[model samples]
Target: MAGLTVAALGVVGFLGYQAAATAPDHPTQARPGSHASQSKEKDKDRGRQKKKSTALPAASGTGERVVYALDDKRVWLVGADGKATRTFEVGPSPASPDPGTYAVTSRNEGGVGSDGVQVEHVVVFHSEGGVVFGFSAAVDGSMPDPNARKRTGAVRESRADGSALWEFAEVGTKVVVIP
Candidate 1:
């Protein structure tokens, strides 16, 4: 009976270790230089490598362009080499723009949005159904909750991402929308 109990204890410990090893990505508590810690580091590197090797969908468009995925709620700034230079998440309004190619028709450094918030990095692309669609970030680094009853087509992004978009996109810059 004693021998059987010891064997069960060893099996339980090994199973617990195995479960931790195969767990999802999260901060690990392994001691430094331990095999567990080393494996965790390797796993993180693998994740980053995977992201680097994965290319944006071909329908995102060719050459330099801003690719917006409506379904994914993400945006990619594609460089001339047809690779994404910057990718970030965006919070699009309920009335999201249709999936189609567009051009940045105008821009404003700062302006008052329909939601009564002071916004910056205003890049207007299209207007439809009495709604003027554009991307903007509140000057105070806040997101806008536009009035649903009124015309609101603002696509809100993080302050840092909004700055990058403002600098890269200019008048006539191509904006591709993917479903």
Candidate 2:
């Protein structure tokens, strides 16, 4: 029994050392629901309680598709009637796509983002110049820092929003990026 216990301790110690050595120098904190509520409160306190407009950018083509505005950091799921069915704010990827129209090229149900966060509902649209732009949601419902630079090219959204986008955008669905 004593020898077995010693062997287990040795294995545990080695594993701990390996984990410590592999840890990142800087770890990110997940943005929680409370933080969002606080942000809303701050916006109200500053008298900026105006509702987010659902209007699509004028130059974005009228179609049944997803429209993303780089300047606004917002997305609109437009219906066949050329009206926005849903709109939500999102975090920009390390690299954004140039203003243009693209089609949903591929999709992965879930995966680890290059930044090491587990995300779901990945909807990819454009890939070129060493950057692939897509949409995903953190599995924990946490958000990465918008101001901090991320390693991957993913427009992070809330889980609910991500699911909506994943459902609305299928292979060959139109995607428009507007500056």
Candidate 3:
């Protein structure tokens, strides 16, 4: 029943997105100066964009890189040929690095994360104001509570994704954060 509900919602959301994209707004009903309406429209557009788009970010530098998008909570592993080899969603970290390029500075095969979770494939990238940012997978295959009041900077991924990232992004690999 839960799966059915999710499938139904996905179908509904896709249909709504398609209708909005192709529908013509009536000129007589246009509220060109209505800030509220404009904001709502932009929100809807962002939702559609997140659902439908996974194209590598244009400004993310070429060559092999790990591209992390702050707003989307998604990461793309790009190859040297400038193609994304893998993309996946991540559990949001309490801390995020600024939008820029950095390199994978360190890594660990397995260890306990700052959040106190037993994790593996630890890939460290950036640090800011005492917060160390990296990607890892919880050994228990669990995700942290987004509402929790923790201050850890581990951007958690699924076990499979973590292993893939570990193999792809070794030390010195470029990591790009984009807003």
Candidate closest to the true structure, highest lDDT = 3
lDDT of 2 at 65: 88
**Candidates 1 and 2: which is better by lDDT?**
2
Residue 4, model 2: Cα distance from true site in angstroms = 58
Q: How far is each candidate from the true structure, as Cα RMSD in Å?
A: 10.1, 11.4, 11.1
Residue lDDT tens for model 1, 65-171: 99888766678899888988998877777577888999999999888976777888989888899778888888776665544665588887887888999999999
**In candidate 3, what are the lDDT values of residues 1-179, reduced to their tens digit?**
99999999999999998887667662234376687578768989998998865778788888999999988888999999999999998997677788999999999999999888999999999888778899999999877666667777888999999999999999999999999
**Pairs of colliding residues, candidate 1:** none
The TM-score of predicted model 2 comes to: 0.68
Off by over 4 Å in 2: 1-53, 147-151
lDDT string, candidate 2, 44-68, tens digits: 8655422533567778897798999
Per-candidate local distance difference test:
0.83, 0.84, 0.88
Alpha-carbon error at 70 in model 2, in Å?
0.8
Residue pairs clashing in model 3 are: none
Provide the lowest-lDDT 10-residue window in model 3.
Answer: 21-30
